[model samples]
Target: MKNDEGEESRVLLENYRVLLKKALDYLWERIKVERREVKKGKRVITKVKVTLSKKEEVYKSLRDELEEVNVLASHYVDKAISDAYSVLRSWRRRAEKGKASLRKPKLKRVYVRVKSTLRKVEGESVRITVRPYEYITFSWSHTWFSPRVKGLELGEPVIKEDKVHLPFRHRLPWFTPLDYLAIDSNLYTLDAYDGEKFVTFSLRELYSLKFGMELKRGRIKSFASKHGRKGGKLMEKYSHRERNRVRDYVHKFVNKLLEMYPVTTFAIKKLNKQEMFQDADDKLSKRISRTVWRSIHRVLKYKAPLYGSLVKEVNPHLTSKSCPRCGRVSRKAGLSGVRGVGSPWTGN
Candidate 1:
């Protein structure tokens, strides 16, 4: 049922996956060896000066090792090594931030990064080189996004098993902001103060959806104990459904807020989740989980660049109790009947 070109594409994808995985495994092994050496050195001194091997040296070694064993083009090996380094760098960063696991990182997804040297683009089509002379051409001439990306610049492409993802970047000029929209996120509401008036976006529906899903999952746990496989699938389905629905709601809510105050700098509270949950009770933790304040902040941060706006995370200390009019922290201050003193955005 499949054509020759489709079959060839499938085979190429598989081969690229295998080759990329092999290179990543070798790089991870080398990283573990380096980590072991560092640990051994630290055991000898109270404050050991540790220095790992340079990235360029590791990259050169990886490229040389991969080239000697694989028959792929040199650029493929280069891109794979680059991706491996990216992974390694990300792991090191997360480890420093106490966000990564103690175990070494593993290759979770198989994909090839196609650099500019491995791809040629013109008009609506891109020709990607798979090997020395072989190529795969992709075109979006008939699709809706074709017209949208007419003048945008194309960056590196990623080749996955089922599809190739093309990244298009648009360069926009920066502008001076006219005003600030200060937003305070709570369990059931998002309050916005736009330097003049206040607006409240009720998050009752979002909270209700999450709370209902949590109850459903709780009830299914009993069924899961009896019927393992089928109940596990049900649990996964509901979990994914909850995640997707929450994501959709957050995106839409953030988009609406951004649209309301376009080109303005938005301010939000910088919340520390770990500190918040340190002494929180079961009910409080569930309420905090349903609020999903971080998702709102993250979506706003990333999407603000596109809207010519900026996002600033202000300190949460005494924010709700601070008077916006006189710039005074009061024990009984609220959001109503506050006149202008100075912009809260300036102090933050």
Candidate 2:
């Protein structure tokens, strides 16, 4: 992320200290006016900077500085950190890992979430280009920032085009805009409400892998009953491959979702997978939701805003229980509220 000349990171960090200081100062002044406590040095905003070809020199130093920050932080910061000091503690742990203790942190460009205003458009699209201290660009084709946060002064971008509509929000621009998306994640599919409806798409590949893994585990468990002390290492190999396959599948699947729906929101149900597998009240229901919440949420958090979109975890209390046709409340007539329904709260 940084040149052999790591000073760039030092410079960028110096800049971070300055910008972060300003953010703290901004917060403190507001708190003082409101009679609140002043806390400094609490957060770092991750941004991907885009510099036009002509302004390359103007952005060069800044780019180098940012790379230096990446180099210095590669080992210390694993993407999210509230305080730079915490980086020291993590680095110390890395030091214990040996000479290669400092893993080179990849350079992260500032991110801009773009959304379009045209309803005819189905989703957002982002195009990005990167060069060392020269040019970096991320472009979007659809509209998606929160209307709630629009018109507020977030940190202003160094460059903006009026024809390219960028949503306005608070100064917390570094916070991935996807933090505000509405995700409708399911085992069978990944649907979105990007302030508009979209054709539901299939995500059963993940399901098939996970299901196969579970079946393999079950088979191994049964095998252990017959060969407990005899085949310990044999089963571990099979389990390891299945687990890796699951991880790879998750990575590829989520990456596709991010690329396809750059400004899309996520709507997911908070499923208790532990309760799902551990208890058998409704085995199918629990298994259906078990892997969804954590896996999808984990990947999408960074992945979504890395492009631009928000994610909202909805209650799955009556998703399948109530009638979609009538919007009537029902608990017994072949329908069950055990799953969950749309929040009476989101409307507010």
Candidate 3:
């Protein structure tokens, strides 16, 4: 009896996801078609206001179709419209910046964004709205998440692969530290200096792994060009593995750093990657792209707060060339030999 109930609940939840995704795709398709039409007609519409007037039209159109899927909620249809508009605006901005090559936005996967209000906790099971009068309730094991979810505002949930993932936020107490740890993030490793001690973490292994994967992918692509479909599948499999491996390593490295230091405040240099690499060689640019610097920064920013730590970014001007003792700037001062310099440790 329990197994049958579980199977039925899973089917209902999947149906709900499909309905939501359909609505989102429908709204997105309409918006993309209209945008292309406007561009082709040489209409000069302010990018910011592009979606504002079309929001109601898109919502109404999606609402009419969603009503046919009786189990799909009305509020979710509105949510889908809002989500599609957000994506469209992002694409428009990208196009203006010359970064977008495609004229139309496409939905390549099945996913839906569920508003937090539509999810209600009821004792052992959570009730998620499918429609105005219909709901699908499923038992959830919040053993580890119970404490974290308490007294926090939940953001929009993402439903994918038969699972609902919720994001929570809460006000945390501000952290203050008597001393600061300055971190110099380099291409190969992270060098950190706290008032009294200096430490470095080797990132060479990670770089090696990335380069190895890149070489493998290159060979795979070359093989795929000759062998066709099966080779293409193998290429995708390896690509996903590479990403997962890099992401996993970065997370583990950052977690260990936070655990080891337990510092109240951390500082890092602000790097303008685009301007720095604009005139660089393609090989150098590819190397930099393979390095997951942005991901490292993002993980540190969010994970530091959980440990009552704060992260700060300072201008990196003259960090490597400036002398610590005499307060002099030299073009020949290399970062390799210069150590125990107290100037970089000084307040900004």
Candidate 4:
């Protein structure tokens, strides 16, 4: 939230950004890299292991090095260090997978990670401590979502440039699934089998939205080459619309599917987009990219718990080539080998 003076907000955001970057740089300097060889089947592969300095060790060093960080509280320094380590950990994972370059990461966002200890609840107001005596309060009494989260627990708040985001957590009990549903994802449809029969969910609307936006973007690019800012804004507008529409379509599809088959274990093929792109032609790669294969699986996973359902990703290798009727692997074994419709349990 903005303070009385405009410059105060800017200063506050800048201060946090600077402190986070400083902490990130400090942790980045202490990164450790090691090489090791492992044998798989008949081949030996070299792997790289990347790590950062221990949190306790870094905390000790930061407390002594960052003297100016005490303007807010001692805990803020610890939070910054923790956030920095999180960034490094993510980068390390991507680097190991050969998805990211082995280079230092830069923290570009302006925000402060407020811990639970620094927050106090007073009726409808939440007061967050900046210093020992100074605090900031936000009211949620009149907010639209306040009633919806009546019994939920408030989590740690994060401070952004113009607002403070308060998170709420709801606990749900784990459930036992009744049956299994196998899914086959394609460019414009998702085919599912529930042991007895098959069901196909059409994704033609999503495909059309993406395809139409691509054409619009192409036109925008040509216009942008002539008129800079106007065309750029048009391109950005369409981009945002495309993302929102795609997300909306995916949510609706998942919601409908979960409604029909609640408390069921859904089996899906685990797809590797990077490997797929490397093996596919440019046209096929573009189509796969438009399909956004991971979005459906990811949404299904997160929303599964809400519907008392579970999603399992099995290996995609030779799934379509295996016979569904009988336990056999052949080029023309399955009913629709081209579609790669295999049994989830046996990968048929």
Alpha carbon lDDT of each predicted model: 0.72, 0.44, 0.66, 0.76
Q: Report the lDDT of model 4 for residue 41.
A: 68
Rank candidates, TM-score, best first. 4, 1, 3, 2
Q: Which stretches of candidate 1 lie over 4 Å from their true place?
A: 1-78, 92-101, 131-134, 142-155, 169-171, 174-178, 193-199, 269-272, 312-347
> 324, model 4: CA deviation in Å?
7.7
Query: RMSD, each candidate, Å?
Result: 6.9, 16.4, 7.8, 5.1
lDDT of 2 by residue, 91-136 (tens): 4344433322333222233222221211112133222111133222
Which scores better on lDDT, 1 or 4?
4
Candidate 1 Cα deviation (angstroms), residue 150: 5.6
Q: Specify the highest-lDDT model's number.
A: 4
Q: Per-residue CA lDDT of candidate 4, range 1-348, in tens?
A: 333333444555576566678887787778888889999668887788997788877687776666565466667777777777788889999988877888888666667767888888887667877767867777788788888878777788767766677787766676679787888887777877787777777778888889888888888899988998998888889889888988998889899999999889988899888777866798888887787669989999999877778899989877765645564776654554344223332353
The per-residue C-alpha lDDT of model 2 at residue 282 equals 72
lDDT of each residue in 193-309, candidate 3, tens digit only = 776666787788888999999999999999999999999899999999998999999999999999987755888777756755664688777777667777888899999877778
